[model samples]
Target: MPGPLLRHVDALVGVGVLVWNLTASQFGELSQQLDQGLDRARDFVTANLPITDAQLDKLVKQTRDGLSGSAPDPVGGARTAAEVFGSILLALVLLFFLLKDGRSMWRWVLRRMTGPNRELTAAAGRAGWRTLGAYSRGTMVVAAIDAIGIGLALVLLRVPLALPLALITFLGGFVPIIGATVAGTIAVLVALAANGPTTALLVLAAVIAVQQIEGNLLEPLVMKRQVQLHPAVILVVVTAGTLVAGIAGAFVSVPIAAVAWRILDTVQRHRAADSA
Candidate 1:
């Protein structure tokens, strides 16, 4: 097999193993953190939306009755709000580095494209940089879009911890086959805990609908131009990552593609040079 292809296959297998182990061991922790955050979220939602007019009237009466002396109702619980904001900040920081320093980062990789076949090195560098950059930016956009859309859904549904849930969605969107599912599951579980089983089920259905839209429509339309790996390859890599290092392995697959691509391009260049 070709160098690049073999590397990709190896990575896929490794990542699949990682993710599976992580899911089995850590899903409970994710669920737990989600539940803890939901408490604040529930209060935030309930306080914002009192179902009945009498509830609305009560709020006005309380405010008029000198409730201004008390602390205002927070939008989310401390931990939940922290989770939401932290994720957004983390993603934005990643975006900043990707957009701003991508070329510089690739220049380091360019150094490896050296020796007698300098032209080949340059060519591969160009291709590698372009391919990887596109993937990075495209994935970021997909994550952002997913987060916003689902956040709005949660808010409208009056689900607690909308922002935190949205953050999870954004991060989860990065995972190929299972990222969104894991993230969406958190939202559903929260809905179950904070609201009821029916509400959780409905939330799960909404997540499924959105993911279908993203997979069938957005991924092909958006990421296709950026990332050249086939959907089958992507799925395999994710599964492999999950199996190997769990979530961490799955997250590393796409990033490693650039390296895998570079190695392939190098081998291709050598073959052409030899033929020449």
Candidate 2:
């Protein structure tokens, strides 16, 4: 990665960590509450339900067995961590190599081709890159707007884990239609769990309001000329991507659509010019 891009990525990671720390503190409290509620519910059931001593003893034994069985496996956890870290390392190495040598590599490939086909290929590549770059820049702005607006709203409402939820909302903005909705739902649920129904409702309204503002104002202002896809086209692509490849597809579909559209547009314009 270039220096500026690396700096931006580091900043985003730092923000994520900050949000995680803030929300993790609140998460501890929520965990304790959940444990206490479970204990109370268990006691109430034990007190009210009709059961024999033998049955109760068996149930207790079964519960203990289940708890033991469910205990975390350190070896498995370590293996998973190692796998994740290794993948990240590999990706970084590959990206570094690509960034260092990508232009020469592309030119080498282009040199093997001849005639109009080569020109068309180069044009399509340029258009795709331009489209992707524009989308990335615009999405960053939109994500910032989402994070700030909803984060301030959560803070005003005194919602616990607000920063973490806002961070999630910002990241989710990268995905097309459904990302923010899913993240906002998590925020509302957190509010409901930590506060009360009234607070939860307020959080829900706030989430909706923020999304409305993002869709109507921020996205239009930031991404208006970046991506040329219509609303219906976006919706269809999002739906198809979601259905075919799930969350990952939904996240990437818009960019891929933009690139494809750019390529097509470039081809058409070039052909028209050549004819003229």
Candidate 3:
């Protein structure tokens, strides 16, 4: 009996660790594109070197027809915000539910397991709290660090829309690989337009280097104490999640995987003990 109890506890503890891992890497999906940069330097050279002054003049018709009466792109700086009104409303609603009733809901789950399964119930609760707390805290910190770093880089580059881009970066950083990749791409693309494709390429390279440092060096140091999973497993889950849930699925795949791993692993170990 004693051995069974200890094993059950061990399994739950492991689950707690898994949850933390998912929470921390939310912004990494976006970071990947940043990692594999756009190779702007090569492109810039190719585009510029191939053309002489006269060729450029011919293309732009000696800058006469090019600048004759061309008005600015009507769509530039077009919308107030790219995020739709509905996303904002949904976020507010989710925040309310989590803040006010999230705890009670877990208590309700624990309450549903009848009879002598009380210990199992408690284990589940521990797993839930660990998942929620670790993911929330880790993701918040990572996103903040990412946003600040990228924002500073953009500022140094004298990129326009720095503040708006920073805010977008912070929000997107919450989504893991895809989020960072998309957000940073936006930054680079915007930079390209504002400065030129060459400058944008440089900005893109900077984003990738920063992400590598964060993932290879910083993440391991910080996450060692949080949750641990093999890299291959994470890749599989991310892929599967994108297939099943699209963006939402991809964003949430880790936490769900963590919880599933925790719950299933816990139950299995306990069952083994019972049979023994």
Candidate 4:
């Protein structure tokens, strides 16, 4: 709606596109390397495996038939893309509306409630929003640190496509446990392809170190201000969330838990005071 907002959005869109294109190009090269390796492995297996000529021919035919039967569906792909784009557009519109009138909407909702329920609702809303904001900011800081640490490590080791991989790592950090693992694996694979297994192992170590630091130091220090959760509790909730709702649940589980705790604490204190 404003010039500054428009400018910020434009800049972010440009940067996102640039990063995506660079990463996609790197992935294309990586895919080719993977294909070549698979081909070599297949050749070796065929050469060494004990089988009659007719049996080998039958096996190859069966594999080819299976692959052909599982051909990519262009229509399905297009439909999925359209659905995703539509959902994104809808979310942006809703976000804009919320930003424009969120306070008024909240006030109106509060007015409709009565007595203790209204007060409790207001308190819960405040706590929930605060937890969400704190978690969002702290998570970004942690992700930035992770990206920088891993990216610098890659650069020091003379790994190719360090920046693109770092960008991916940063984005992946938002997805919680699975995201970082997948991103780090990609970096290791790239290192293995460009350098060697030795360099790849080194990269793997660096990734593990960075993740440990983030989990042990960065997250606790920053996130404790808003939400103090035991590591075991977090693990259980995260696992449950991932099972229930995939990435979105994993991303939000902690914040939701924190907010719920805050609300319960508030309610308990209110009850204690009323009794006194």
- Top of the candidates by lDDT: 4
Tell me the spans in candidate 3 whose CA falls farther than 4 Å from its real position.
1-98, 101-105, 229-232, 239-244, 272-276
Candidate 3's error at 238, in angstroms? 3.9
lDDT of 3 by residue, 85-130 (tens): 4566887688667656777887887688787587776776576558
Using Cα atoms with residue i matched to residue i, what is each candidate's TM-score against the true structure? 0.56, 0.71, 0.59, 0.75
Question: Model 2, stretches more than 4 Å misplaced?
Answer: 1-13, 16-18, 21-90, 239-246
Clashes of each: 24, 0, 15, 0
Q: Please report how far candidate 3 places residue 148 from its true position, in Å.
A: 0.5
Candidate with better TM-score, 2 vs 4: 4
Reference-based lDDT, each prediction: 0.72, 0.79, 0.67, 0.80
Give candidate 4's error at residue 53 in angstroms. Answer: 20
Can you write out model 1's per-residue Cα lDDT over 151-234, one digit (the tens) per residue?
A: 888888888667667767888877866788788878887787776767777888888888888877987788675466776877
The count of residue-pair clashes in candidate 1 stands at 24
Better of 3 and 4 by lDDT: 4
RMSD, one per candidate, in order: 16.9, 7.6, 13.2, 5.7
Q: 171-232 in candidate 4: lDDT tens per residue?
A: 88876676789889888877877776688789999999999999989988988766776767
